[model samples]
Target: MCAVSDDVQISVRKMDMRYRHETLLKDLNFDVHTQDVFVIMGESGCGKSTLLRHMIGLTRPRHGDIFYQGKSFWHCGPEQREEMMQHFGVMYQNGALWTSMTLVENVALPLKQFTTLTRRKIKHAVEFKLALVGLDGYGDYYPAELSGGMRKRAAIARAMALDPKILFFDEPSAGLDPINSKRLDELLLELRDNFGATIVVVTHELDSIFSIANNSIFIEPKVKSIIGRGNPKKLLETTDNPKIIEFLTRGERYE
Candidate 1:
């Protein structure tokens, strides 16, 4: 097993990215410390998703390194990278559950593929994860049978299937109603506390960011780099940078 010191979970170093001829972000550097709810916040079309894909090895950065638990994800050999990937769990903008699969089956997929656990044991674990996400008895339901909130919860259960060390969420609250979005936020905090997982969230939701983020960085669209870095709440109250303040305060000063 690999050992990561308790202080840092992942590090982004001098990352440069471009699309066609347009540079999206350049020299992006940040560290997501262990067990933090780290937010990557920016307005829409800021390439947050692109950066995330690069971290997950879906896209190669033009220049830079993303370190996972002190191991260079870009520099590692295939076998080493594959070993590193086993520790990640990701949830997309939409729930992204298979419409045909029951909730338990969806959650069980990861465990069945990754571990030697028997079917019986996987079933037990699936039920536990389902219950954790407040879907204790709905594991038999298909994705299409559940409401939007329930589908998101089911997807979260699946993400937690392998007890991942780090969880990545892309716009977790994108389509939910306000109430469901709040519930999802609560669930995220619960997951972080219960699992002590490092969570990297890519979102532009101001309410969610203030409520959940322990640390964050705002991507600057104009400069093609990060403009602000720190606790969202503090930055909201203290930042003089117009873009950072405007983004966080929604152009309204704290009154």
Candidate 2:
């Protein structure tokens, strides 16, 4: 409901995530609208990252389907799914950059693998992606040469190399100090507002959950379902559920 537009970008219907016979999540249904900063937040063991994996085609749901523009992702052919995945930019919990590569080489990997662009053009594209993430002149730097935040930004540049429509992030702020986390949050909003990119983030950082997410779902591991949904600030103001309130308040008494 916090979405500015009613246009649904991704839909998860009757989804169940399981590892073998043990169900991790059940009957999960949600809609991520176009341009939404949709946060998936919960306690550590909940299925937040698992749900992200399901959405991105890295893992298949044990039951039900995930749809993009009404086409079933899980039920699609491998070729079709690979095509869909090309347009999705994912930044994992770790920056995932190869220490042996420079930023330019790292960013150019996707373009080289997926497109027919010449080496010169690929370099040009890589520079643009780096600039987009505020890393304009760091192209020659290796992952070890940068700070943690800068490394994360470098990873983001690589993810954006293909010009993805929907960007997915896993705990983007996990290792940052408060100031760096806030800067990362600002960059995410800039991506959403300036480029109209739809974003899905898996994070439990309340500061970020409130700062960036326009819409969200809080999954509870014990219940194996979503226990909270909507804007984090609004949920803090309006919800009476103890677990949710406790979560939003960091277990302090909410007036």
Residue lDDT tens for model 1, 1-255? 234566888988889988777889999999999889999988899989888878777777898888887789987788888888889998866789988889998999999899999989999999998987779999889999988878887887898899999998888887677886888788788878988888889998888999999999989888899988989999877888888887887878654
Which residue pairs does candidate 2 place in steric collision?
none
Q: What is the lDDT of residue 21 in candidate 1?
A: 79
TM-score of each: 0.90, 0.90
- The local lDDT score (0 to 100) that residue 205 gets in candidate 2 is 91
lDDT of 2 by residue, 112-230 (tens): 99999999999989988888667899999999999887888888888778878899998888877787678778878888888888999999898899989999998988899999899
For candidate 1, give the lDDT: 0.86
